[model samples]
Structure formats: C-alpha cells, structure tokens
Target: MNETELASYWNNNAPAWIELSRAGYDIYRDYLNTPAFFTILPDVKGLKGIDIGCGEGHNTRLLATKGAIVDAIDISSLFIESAIKMEKEYPLGIRYTVASATKLPFNNDSFDFATSFMCLMDLPDQEQAVSEAYRVLKPGGFFQFSIEHPCFKTPYQRKVENAQGDIAFEVGNYFKSANGTIEEWIFGDAPDELKNRLPKFRIPNFHRTLSWWINTLISVGFSIELLHEPYPDEEAVLNKPKLKAAREISYFLQVRCRK
Candidate 1:
C-alpha cells in the first residue's frame, strides 16, 4: 500500500486502540515491549527528542515525564487527535503532529535525538524512515528504535506440549518476509468476548531479517551504540504465568545508534 492507503488503515483502527490503552498500557506492551525499550532508553532530562510513530502519545508522555521536550508524530490523524485530547486533560508538554514516520515534517537537525517504539517494522518503507531519522538529528545525535524481533517473531506459531503438560512454542516462516493484516488484534487487558465483537484492527506490517535492519542503519551512516533482545524477567513470568515462552525467546529487539 502507498502512504495514504497505509495511513487510512491505521486511522481506521485508532479508536479501538485508544479504548484498549485508555487507562494505561495493555498487557502486551506493559509486559513485553515496554520493559525492553526502557531498559536501553538513554537519560533525556532537559533534552529535545522526536518520537516517530508516536501512537496515541503514551510513550511521548512518558518521555516528557522523564524531562525530555518531546515532539511526537503519527500517521493516523485519529491517533493524533486522541493524543491531543489526552494532553488537554493532563498536560505533559508534548507536541503531537500527524506525520509519516518515513517523512517527518521537521527541519534538518531539528532534534537532539530520535526514537521509534516498535514502529519501523510497521512502516512500508523502513529504509526511508531510518534515513529521515538520520536527517533530523544533529551530528552525534542518537536514534533509538525498537522492533518485533525479526528472527523470533514468527508468522506461523504453534504450541508444543510435553508429557507433563509443560508447553513450548514452535514457529515457522521465520525467514519469509511478507505483508498482510491479521483478522484482529487482542489486547492483553481486553476480555476475549469484547475483542471478538469489535472490528478487526487492520494494518500492514513488513517482516525483515535481523541482518536487514542492522545493515540499513549502517548504510544510512549511523553507528551502532547498543543492541538488546529482551526477554521477560523472572518475576514477570511468575506473575503472568502464561508468558514463559517470552522468557525463553526474545519478543522485542532494541537498537540505539548515533549519527
């Protein structure tokens, strides 16, 4: 899909996403992605940063609370609108815009740093987004991003149960790159019945290999500073019970690079 088509896809799903995250993080983000990303997040006190694909501005607010002057943008106008409404109710000094991740509307070297939280993989043209991220940061600035681990987040998955009923996850299509929409998305905090009744949240996502991601960053003249493939901590496993597969295998990968 082209940019407008892609934007429409997310725009259509924004309300449901807002509902899912109205109170706080739904379980998937709260447990899986958030921990991994924040573990590698740099101190941004008194800094200027831009969050690409800042969906509904949750993480943008978090950055503001951490003392970063944040300019956040998203492709979906609905998401941007929701974020604006949120800012009015509880101000955190974040400026939200409706913009594409591949093409930010900021001037060159406009920010001290750049960030993308699990957004690059969803973008149809990830290279352009990385290039734009490189363009917006001042020399020596960093771009930190998180993604669904390409090597581990499989398109086809199955659970294998042992004789004692212990379960393990098996996966397929790890190397095949594809784009398609899931029939629906299930938030961790939502009741299964409620999820079934809602329209399927549709968006296109591209899957690429780990090599492709690292090579793209280097090709865009960014030096890798840190990389992390985060798994659930023990306490999370004990509390959540069903997330043991996440503990054994990585679900999210973080990459921080400097221009």
Candidate 2:
C-alpha cells in the first residue's frame, strides 16, 4: 500500500488507540518500552526536537516535559487532531502537524534532535524517513527511535503454551520484509469486557530485518550510538501477567544514532 492508504488505516485506528492507550491498555509501552527509551535518552533541556510519527502526542508531551521545544508530526490527520486537542487543553507548547515521516515539512538542520516512538516499522519507505530525519537534524544531533524487535516480532509469530503453562513466542520470517500487511488485533492486556466491545485496531505491519534498519541508518549518515532491547520487569509482569512473554523474548528495540 502507498503512504496515503497506510495513513487511512492509522486514522481509523486513532480513536481506539487514544482511548485504550490512555486507559493504560498498552501495557508493554507504558510499563516497559517508553520508560526504557527515556531512561537512556540524554538530557534534552533547552533543545529543539521533532517527534516523527508521534501518535496522539503522548510521548511528544513527555519530551516537552523534559524541557525540549518539540514539533510532532503524524501522517494521520485524525491522530494529529487528537494530539492538537490535547495540546490545546494541556498547553505543552508542542507544535503538532499532519505530515509524513518520509517527507518532513521542515528545513535542513531544523532540530537539535529527533525521535520516533514505535513508528518506523509502519512507514512504507523506511529509508526515506530516516533520510528526512537526517536532513532535519543539526550537526551532531541524535535521533532516537523504538520499534517492535524485528528478530522476535516477525511476519510469522505464534503464542506457544507448553504443558507446564509457560508462555513463549515462536517467531519466524526474519528474512522476510512485509509491506503494508494488515494486522488486526486489540491489545492483549485490555479488559475482556472492553476488548469484546472494542474494534480490533487495523495496523499496517512493515517488517524489516535488524541489519536493514542498522544499514539504512548508516546509509543516511547516522552513526550508531546505542542499541537497547527492552522487556518488562518482574514488577510489570506482576501487574500484567501477559508481559511475562516479553521477559522471555525481546519485544522492543530502541536505537540512538548521531547525524
């Protein structure tokens, strides 16, 4: 699918995503992935930043709270609308725009740093998105991003429960790259009462190998600085037992690179 078609899928997903995520149904993100991203993130005090593919601006608001002047963009106008509404109510001083990551609407060297939270894997053209991020960053600026771990979250993934009731993931297709593959599912941790009522979010899965991501960043003039594989901790598993699977296999990958 093209970028326009992909945006529609996310636009459709925006309402449920905003509701469920705000209600704390996206446990892995709120509990593990995002916390890990911020744990390793360098201080952004007084820095200018852009958050590409910033869904509903939750993480973008977090960046703003960290003392960064932030510009956040999402391809889906609906997502941008929700983000802008929150910005208006909360007044975080974030500039939210409806734009594509592949074609950033900004001048060269426009930001001190950049970020994308669990978004690159959904873009149709990952390389161009990375290049646009490079184009917008000032000298020595770093771009930090997080995505579903390619090695573990692949085109073929199955939940395996052993006789002992231990949950594990059986994943394959690491060598395969999926473009705009429609994945229909709701957050596993969502309350069963609410899950039955909620529409399954239709997300476009664009899968690429670990090497492809690293090489693409390097090709776009970003020097690899830090690589992180984040999984939920024991305390998190206690709150949400489904997160135990993440402890067994990596669920998210965070990368930081310099321009």
Q: Best candidate per TM-score, number?
A: 2
Segments in model 1 whose C-alpha atoms lie over 4 Å from true places: 23-25, 163-165, 180-183
Report the C-alpha lDDT of model 2 over 1-259, residue by residue, as the tens digit: 8988988899999898999999988888888999999999999999999999999999999999999999999999999999999999999899999999999999999999999999999988899999999999999999999999999999999988989979888888889899888999999888898888879999989999999999999988899999999977788889888788888889999999999
Query: Per-model C-alpha lDDT, please?
Result: 0.84, 0.93
| lDDT at residue 127 of model 2 (Cα atoms) | 92
Q: Against the correct fold, how does model 2 do in TM-score?
A: 0.98
TM-score of predicted model 1? Answer: 0.93
Could you tell me which 10 consecutive residues in candidate 2 have the lowest summed lDDT?
A: 231-240
lDDT of 1: 0.84
